[model samples]
Target: MHTDARVLNNQSLIEGDICIIGAGAAGISIALDWMNTSKKVILLEGGGFEYDDKVQDLYKGKTTGQKYFPLKASRLHYFGGTTGHWAGMCSPFDEVDFRKREWVPGSGWPISKKDLDPYYAKANETLKLGPYNYEFDYWRKELKDLNPFPLDDKVIRNKMWQYSQAHFGDLYKEAIVEAKNIHLYTYANVVDILAGEGVQHISSVIVKNHEGKTHTVKAKHFILACGAIQNARMLLASNSQAPRGLGNDHDLVGRYFMEHLEIASSELWLFRPFPTNLYSWEYGVTRASAELAITEEIQEKERILNGTASLLPLSVGKHQKPRMETWQDEDPRKSSESLFKNWSEADEAAKSEKGAIERAFQLNTRIEQAPNPNSRVTLMAEKDELGVPRVNLHWELTALDKRSVRRIHQLIGQQFGIAGLGRVKLMDFLRDEDDDTFPDSTNGGWHHMGTTRMSDDPGKGVVNADCRVHGISNLFVAGSACYTTSAAPNPTLTLVALSLRLSDHIKRII
Candidate 1:
């Protein structure tokens, strides 16, 4: 049953077996997994089914160090979370992504890809993805003309990707509202987590809204399914008892913030027109596509981060501006319009270019940023309408991150020369060998990760292997906040799968 928290009386006490905060992809996926179960699950969403400007203001704050998108526009505040405006690209992390690399300072996860394999298949159902298999051969048999380039398979490999436009708000709204066991609460923004005696366990939480309504939620188990930014902000803001922040005895709650570095790398000028649908996407129509990715062995040998290179037609792509420059409007709606308008103009201008070469394509990179402690989220003194402190972001990138991107493209150029099929011209920013700075055009994938990272030792992380907050027995975080390191692909798929794994663990313990 669906209930708006605004309608609930002040001081209303909501009791449930499991209280899941922030009804985004992770929260909804976990709630759906509990369908028909005897447990009473409470799913809380700060905004209603649609976008609300007031609720969005809570996400607004300041950004420092690296240039970034407007805090308010970076993520959606509605029921669907950022997926409401997401491009819906999906791919699994390589096995090496979960392993410790000597070159990457703070890389490696407590769990491995093997642990998430079953959950990944189960997550595909929730994400509306194709078969669990991401093998190029499997997709080649299923899709038409999915042929790879003539690169050495031993060094470089195709990173297959699937697409899904499943906005949870639009797709699962009715199901969540109709479910008998799940209680869906809208306009319920959790402000502070109230802990009992020793702060070892979360007793209940305090939620408030702009309507001057304050409520309490009591549950046997609490799962914070909010995004990485909000999840850390919430923890840091709830400093009444745990002065250092709950589960933050080591001062590591909001550290190691990571994003996938997405930027224009080089130009791939093929000797001849490469005719294959393998490395292309048709927006909403294409079921699956592939991007050129460096093999695990190559990454280990080269001592670089895992990344993929995607091809965009040089005709239109050459004129395309960086995403950081185009998506500047504070209002997400306006920002999207501006971005689409820019893309449309680029495509339109491409049609009029007489000398546009069909054989050339821009090689854009989607790579993982090296985890740096300085890249973090902190709490600001300014309070939102609900009296919760706003967030302050410091997105610091390291020299390793810069070196990795340049090396990845250099490797690509070397491989292209070996294949004798094309030549790669490095971008202007990468032309200078000693330049250690990224221009304002540097674009990130808008993936927030590692704020509440997981580790078996509390000194190193906020959460444990099972997603439970280290010091708090009944408190858990169920999203990218627990990610130890960011991978090349988008986080939505792995986050959903991780949430499912957490859901199963909660069933056994809670």
Candidate 2:
């Protein structure tokens, strides 16, 4: 039987077979998986049914590393979590993202891509995505027939398109409302954990509300889907009983923080012009044979399979401009408008400006960042109103990260020229000869990842092979944070797959 906590008043504590934190993509996916199970499931979300600034302020922190858009009231918090602002780009991780590359340090996942393939179909069904096949033939019909994107010229190459465009809240709302065994509680913020002897087991979780009233929930298993940053923060903040924090025995809970370093505001002018009408048809759909296809054939065939990367084609106005800002004016009422209006107010000048070359495609090359311990999210001395310590986001990159970016630039440029897409110019315009001159020139993609990575070794990573905290018997993690490698593809789809996989694992445990 499921109960709506929002309808219930204060001091409401519920017990279940499993308790999931954060009702975003990860949590909802897992909840749906066990909806008909015999076990009682309780899903606790920090925010209420709607978005609010008072709760959103809980995610604010001191920014570091590259410049980033301030944590938006829209970006960080709420009932649905960050999925509210997500541009539903869905692609699976490259096979290389699972392998342990000798060249990249702290690499390799406890489970391979094949290990998770079975769940991808269910993931697609949950996300309202297209068919299951990832082969190029699936997307052949969607091509404009002029010629395949230059990468297609390479005989071993495989390309895929956008498979799923969905909002988690809307997609899963009806099912959740009618779920038989899942209890969803909004406005209940989990603040602490009560652990058993030796801190190896979790007894129950402590949650609070705006009224300062609290409730404690006991469950056989606990999974934190509160996103990459908050997952680490919660574990570190629960340091009262466990001195180094829960599952931090190796001092490795929040280390090795990383985010994709994206180069943007760049343009790719067409060598041969194509029809403008194709934009609507080709924008985003991913089935192996639909409008898009991406496969690992090229990297494997060329023996260049150390790390992962993806090529994305964005439609832009005929004329292209160089400048890209941290934020855009998507919502006028949002803080981004006030902070970024100066640059956006000048959009009229930007559009009418002369000497601009018409662009055919806006290509963004997102590559993997190898884990580096120096790049981390440490706990701050100060605590929140609930006494949970804040997270000090210390995201950093390594020399290998720069190499991957440079190699991607060279490969994309060569492929564009070969495929007659015109010579691709980088947004970060460093000459090929001056590659090693400056490393920090690239900008943050804001696609944050790592920090509490999943690995086979308990000593080196926070979560074990199945995203279970090593010593902690029933605690698990889901989301981009568990990613062993921050691959080039958009992580939304892969994260959902992992979440679904976690649910399957939980079913077996029960």
Best by TM-score: 1
Error in Å for residue 221 of model 1: 0.5
Query: Which tens-of-lDDT digit does each residue in 1-510 have in candidate 1?
Result: 999999998999999999999988999999999999999999989999999999999899999999999999999998978889898899998899989899888777899999999999999989999989999999989988876888898888999999998998899999999999999999999999989999989999998888999999999999998899999998998889999889889999899999998999899988887785888897789999999899999898988889999998888897788999999999999989998999999999988975539888899999988888899999888988888888889999877777778888888888889999889999998888788788889998879999999888888889999999997899999999999888899999999999999999999986
Candidate that scores best on lDDT: 1
The residue-by-residue lDDT of candidate 2 on 314-414, one tens digit each, is 33322222212425322313644453454444444455644433344455445566688877778777767767777677656655655555555556666
lDDT of 1 at 427: 92
lDDT scores of the candidates, listed in order: 0.91, 0.67
Candidate 1 Cα outliers beyond 4 Å, as residue runs: 354-356
Per-residue error for 437 in candidate 2, Å, reads 8.1
Model 1, position 35: C-alpha lDDT score? 90
- Candidates in order, TM-scores: namely 0.99, 0.85
